[model samples]
Target: MRRLSTIIALFISLSAFADEGMWMLGNLNKQSRQTMKELGLKFPADKIYNPKKTSLTDAVVSFGGFCSGVVVSNDGLVFTNHHCGFSAIQQHSTLQNDYLQDGFVARTHEEELPNPELFVRFLLRTENVTPRVLKAITPGMTEQDRQAITDSIMYAIQDEIYAKDTTLVAVVDPYYGGNEFWLSVYRDYTDVRLVFAPPSSIGKFGWDTDNWVWPRHTGDFSVFRIYAGKDNKPADYSPENVPYHPPYVVPISLAGYKEGTFSMTLGYPGTTERYLSSFGIEEMMNGMNQSMIDVRGVKQAIWKREMERSDAIRIKYASKYDESSNYWKNSTGTNKVIRQQKILERRREMEATLFRWIQDTPAERENLLHLFSSLELNYKARREAGRAMAYFGESFMNGPELVQLALEILNFDYEAEEKMVMSRMKKLLDKYANLDLALDKEVFTAMIKEYRSQVDSLYYPDFYATITDEYNGSDHAFIDSLYAQTKITTPLGLKLFFEQDSTYNIFEDPAISLSIDLLVKMFDIHQVIQEPSTNIERDERLFNAAIRRMYANRNFYPDANSTMRLSFGTVRGYTPFDGAEYDYYTTTRGIIEKAKAHAGDRDFTLEPEVLDFLSSRDYGKYANTDGDMSVCFISNNDITGGNSGSAMFNANGELLGLAFDGNWEAMGSDFIYEPDLQRCIGVDVRYMLFVMEKLGKADHLIKELNLR
Candidate 1:
């Protein structure tokens, strides 16, 4: 295990990078350039990210990946990526209407459509569960013991809390080594419906070739509404439900952002790996890069071959193929940049500096070196575990039933993991009846063989024992013989055999069931022991320390993952990749021009109806940028995955455009907030209203926008 000093050094360096680095709050160090506060900005008290506040209940309601919308007229009206809304567009698509290919508008409320698996989540709350959780077992607990203790304590806590409101759920987040923890709560509403979507021709003017690389003109925004019971609280979708009214929704503005203007992104920015060790970063750069190259390259080769042979398959996997290719290609470029820049070397130096500082300070020195060593050990374990987890999640594709079974098993503590032998028997009979005999036999045989090869062989010698007999298609015979000998023909007996007594032919049992158990154990091991040993606690301590430092220095409110966050920025652009400069704007006319030049491709065709509307040049509800009103526009707000459907507002918090995509150069914004490269693009509510009112002839929606 690496020492605490070593890990801290690595952590500080990585966190100071280009994309994933977190900026200190309140512009203390950054004031020389610009600050969010300078732009006449005010973040709502409710929206601030305060670790102590503990509830990020409101997630930016988003449709697809690109669009931006706010939860206005609250019955959960989510405005988001137009491309994000594409699936819903396709769902409403038909021979008669073909919304995806054409686009449609709901003239009346009755004409509004619903799509499958489309929903929005409002972050209900978050909790710092550090004391309550860590109280179960102290640091340095054994893996098995740690797993058992955590499960027992966590289950007890959740059962006590969640029993009241099913909506009140919890997910544990390991922070700062094992010293700190957080529990995120969510109010999940599954019944989300599409309120409006423009035709794809207008929404995705340029498609894949133009996706990340944007000169860029795509009005990618869509709208959906959330429904709940009459009491204004969350409830499942029902015929009696009504539109949710949000307590606060941003008001749209005709005023737009100027270059150098300050902006704020007030939504959840998923995760930051800024605190990783230099070793960790190198592994990813080397390991993940190689993996991407292998998988994506192979997949691309296969896809291209299949595309030549089967057009139908090509169309079916078109999105996936493009996504994989883009991921690999971009990753290749990103990795190269990461490697050549000596990012790892710089980070190592930073770690050493921090260590020297810590060692010099006797007042705070608590001999954290042992703790750091433990962290290094855990990192090694985690890397191995990650590989295993990836294979299990994607490649193996465990059956839903087995997944459920595994979750159920892990729901219990260590004693439960060992003692639930009989429960396995009861489940076996039911599962056996459903298993496809041939598939099960083959799958089980292969799984055991693989486990024996990859997993610690000492823990799984019995799995390898059955490989020979099972391969000859004698699995059933072996199972019957084992049952006869053990006098434990029940499913419980079979499970006990696998769990406790590994002498028999447990090979007949499902691999998924065993895999699930293994995975649960792995998670338990990680959370309870390994995670504590690593940087989780140290990171938390550092972050909290940093926060305290900021509070003392600037009196800034510490950032938290609360229900809302208001980040203010401006509408500026920058140069990316090869020094290609991007100006801060794309106009409505750009959409029309792109449509005119389109070659025939499913992702890139103009709907005749929309073309006709564009040809007419009506500009009904469109707000003019300067004297010439343009429909779609851009801003420079630092938003990521969780900020979908967030409203972009002007000085008085009036609606500007609905924010959608960030420039490709800003994908790194997920890890780091870059003022220069990151740009938030949105559809002007004015243009959206214009399209609905004039082109789609849907005065009803225009009326809904309340733009009398």
Candidate 2:
């Protein structure tokens, strides 16, 4: 293993270049500033991030920590992706009032609907405190000891910051794999409301078929308003709360941009493993990604049937389906791009160069050799465990709603669990109408079959033996029996079970028993895999430190960890194939063409009113010079999952579009950035405005943006 590691590391070469980094907002050094200037940035670096003054960073916010949004008006009107607000929209939709089917536009502030548990956070400032953190570590400290000390120091910093201002949330984030750390402060606003959202036909145009594909026409934009107390501080949802007055609001630009234009994006990008080793990449491609794709494909197949059959089911399952399908398609695309781009092979070559560099430098060689060897050995050792975890996660955790409900019942106190279960049951039945027992049973059976086939029997739950012996190795029989025997499958049965004061043995329930067994097996496997890796974290920190030193001359940005970041690039197009070239911008023509192609399909069908606007070509002021309404545009900006609702600004720092998706060819960007091929897909601000004004007749929203 050591010999193989050394050989592979000896051939590694660094390939960081172009607009390929999610740069820290507080650490825009001289080199990064120069790069941004060269890319056509007109504003000074201080204008982008100023603690004492309102800057561009103040306008960008973390939308519920999972996506990004921008403050577009002084009254805190937030702009984000429709999919980011999907769950809230679904919550408000029903057969009589289906906002997901027919678009919704809040004509007045009073008309807007409040979303429960929704929040947006504005970044106050970011400060580097690596020195203070590392001061707590001693030379002879073990990895666990170092972690404990680090956590203590981090808590101390957070406490100190919080003591100064209780409203501000202070978080110390580790970067460069724990070699560095930054302290970020944010003010969270919880009283967010839905202002506007186009129907699924426009917001989710092409649906699963066109999710990650380029030349997209999906509007993908939603508007929400953040409300605060009379004092203008963060507050819970109340009628007394007023619209928040933001420090900065992005100025909308009606002048549409073209190819080669300078573009910048700011958002909280979720995660990226750009420095992952070849072995890790191999495992992701062959194990994790493939498992996700296969399992989600089976689950979605079951859901689609139920959703298509009933409008109520469609609303209940819409958000769930979208969440599952998004990553499923992403996994499929990542696998394809990884293979097409030879990403694993390239990583191996890069590792070889790093090993050669380390050997040449004796200081680094002695320090990092063991780290490299450990990485290789650890990955090999944990492959089976990782695969097992993936199977377990997909099967039990993400498979059916029933499994999760069962797990909840098993884990919580009886009285508290009863109340929670009763509340959930009432909500599911009242809001979603009914939980489809047949569909869930089918899903459970399918998932179990896949889990049994993919994961080793050694890691399998004991319930599998019951299924095999008692049910004659039949997943169908096992699932049918479980559902038939469990009262939790029915609303009345759950209510009656909760109402009864008699002590109930949750372990006797088939579903709860199965879930508990699965949980135990998963935890046991995880422990077995992690028990041997006592020094892995320390070794990784050292390894990352060495890499940073080796590439000291080049600019290094930490991997995305749901922190605010800025990425800059040019509006560019690519020839994904030998003879086919993709244009940088897509127009209304593509939407019409898609609608015509799939006339009766709900995913592709457009509302008659929207189609009429497209046919008339009366774009008003939203049309580009060619007299065509631009829908979506592509750029080479580096982004990932959490950047879904990020604002795309032009050279002058004016809002041009909302970054929503990454092209399918760029799906592997989380691992390796292909500057020429990777593209960020954004819905044009003009299209959003057009949808608001012409289709939804949201004049109030248009005025709120204060368009220039």
Candidate 3:
């Protein structure tokens, strides 16, 4: 039924030298291995990934399913990005013992804080399941039918594996668009605990101001321990659990990197759309990104201003603010680079090449041309609806904390009265667990105002009508009144929300009613774009297949889909613009200078003792050969969002640092990789050891690591 697999090998990258692919670890061919060796990797290919025996694959962890982590000690010590573990650090904090502000250190095993629901999954293996997945599609099948069939097959596969082993979970993910599928199985250990963390001054030194910037000084690393049952198998949290012994735990290399030192990163990168057509790129730039930027710009402004005045608010909302601002700046940088690089024009040029390459096959060529036309038309037809949807998402689903509670309740299945009401109350309790209500009200007002101003009434909730009718069109006054009058806001109403009463009509509450209406309207917009979005998804897959045919001579790596991927390149710097060359690495000197530059800024102002220690020339065994302490470094290794906290290793497969970010100029790397401009920013291993040793005084933890 016309799977693109028959047309061409669905390639995921441009060329070998660009180091542009989030290469599948299990799928590395001989040519890929040769290329890696040429770049700098010293290990034999099989040594890195062998299912029969434990290898480097066992050392990496799917950090909380969102970010990446690596096993440092055989005792299950997992090292991940501080930002990755930010929520857990914040969760254990209190006004009396503010872990977010003071940072955390567990000298003994019992001191390590247990985080509920936090998990680390080890990749069991990845298998190509394209034929099995594609068999679900039939001629004349609707997108809905195609999806339902595929989902059932995938669920069956996962269910079979789960029935065999309770610890194992399986996922079938589509890659190279939907042209290919891969099944990945993992062993999830649920007893992960926070071990060590540096103060915000160290962990998140530059804050949002330096988030995506290069020459980064932030340590950006956190430590956790994975606890397993008596047999070293996955288990729920228990006092009897012991540290897990990994199959392989690479040593930390004290000898630092040269400008051209070889490096590699193995992690799960969430997503990348390197094969998107010109029309899709333009649609995202003009509609989706703009709406996201506009909506978040308002929410973050209010949230950030309030966070500055109050430490309690800052601790409560730091993670939320970081999450919102991250993509806000990402969309900002994405649009900027697209304009500066003329990315849309470049994509059209590539498509033109594909159009000419298949001129000999009239039938195939016509189909290719029709695919392009459909993509352009589809993107154009759904432009306004897509923009409205983005606004709705950024405003309600993400902007207001109450909306999160509302959506959670709407999705949960409450069978009995007591269970339903008690569950609802649990949600209420958790809402205040991490969120500050006063700040939420501030955010709610700003978000609703911006959403109303930017989007049409067609995309808004029925509550907008109430605002116009009962509140005289004043969003500020309406939101304020809603918060003041909503039953959920009152203690009695909250108690009732948790009480054993199935008669509680959650929809009768103003906040819940408004949230439901907004969500319902958002779903309406979603329906309007569904057809075109489905068409785009299908056509994009075919387009990439066509691209593989046009560039059949070049080697390709599959696009990342939150699976284990390996990429290697040299530690190198770049020239962001003419006459401006950035060094490959930054030292503690840069940190001190930045701290001085933004002296009064909370983002840059470090604790006086931290700054004094850096300036005191206490560079000991961990110092770089140049006599300055290395803070962070950059490499050309391919990585993306979920690769945060991935292990960055040297030629000998020894740990060098933790991959935490990519330079700002290459924000569009997700869409198109420019090897010349792109760089993976990592926290040097020595700095992490230094922080743990000097600041945390956790020498016992350092002694556990195999330091070279």
Q: Name the top lDDT candidate.
A: 2
- Top model by TM-score, which number? 3
| Model 2 vs. true fold: TM | 0.94
Q: TM-scores of the models, in the given order?
A: 0.67, 0.94, 0.95
Candidate 1, 1-708: lDDT as tens digits:
456655654444333222222232222245412344455555443333343352222434423323334665434556676655664565455456656555666655455665435555554545667688767675666556765766676677667667777776555655433345556554555566776777666776676556655666666676677766787666655677777766555544545556654444445443344445555565565555545654455435555565446544443333445445655655565466455455567556655655555566564346443434554565565665544443333212332233333344434343555324444544444344332333333343344334344445333323234635563645445433433443233456546644666654443444434445556555653454356344443543443353233224432222222233345566666776585666666666676666667666545567677667766666633645454446555566655544555666654445666655555655544333445556676666666666656766666554455332
Error of 3 at 79 (Å): 0.7
Candidate 3 Cα errors over 4 Å, as ranges: 1-13, 415-428
Model 1 misses residue 386 by how many Å?
A: 4.6
Model 2: per-residue Cα lDDT over 119-172, one tens digit each: 999999999999999996887887778888889999999999999998999999
Please list all clashing residue pairs in model 2, or write none if there are none. 9-352, 10-352, 11-352, 11-353, 12-349, 12-350, 12-351, 12-352, 12-353, 13-350
Put down candidate 3 lDDT per residue, 1-708, tens digits, no spaces. 232432322222256663667888778878878878888778777878888887888899999899999998989999999999998898788788888888899989998899765899899888888899888688778777887888888888888888998778999888777778888999999899999999999899998899888879999999999999999998878889999988899788999999989898999898877878888788888777887789888888988898898887887788888887888888898899888887776676666656666675787776665776788898887988998887778788878887787666566555758645554655466566777777788888888788879887777788878889998988878878888877666566655665635777777878888877876787788889889988887788788888776677777777788899998889998999999999999988998999889989999888877878778767689988778899999999988889999999898889999999887898888778888999999999999998898878899999899999
User: Residue 25 in candidate 1 has what lDDT?
Assistant: 24
Q: Which residue pairs clash within candidate 3?
A: none
Q: After superposition, how far is residue 540 of candidate 1 from its true place, in Å?
A: 8.7
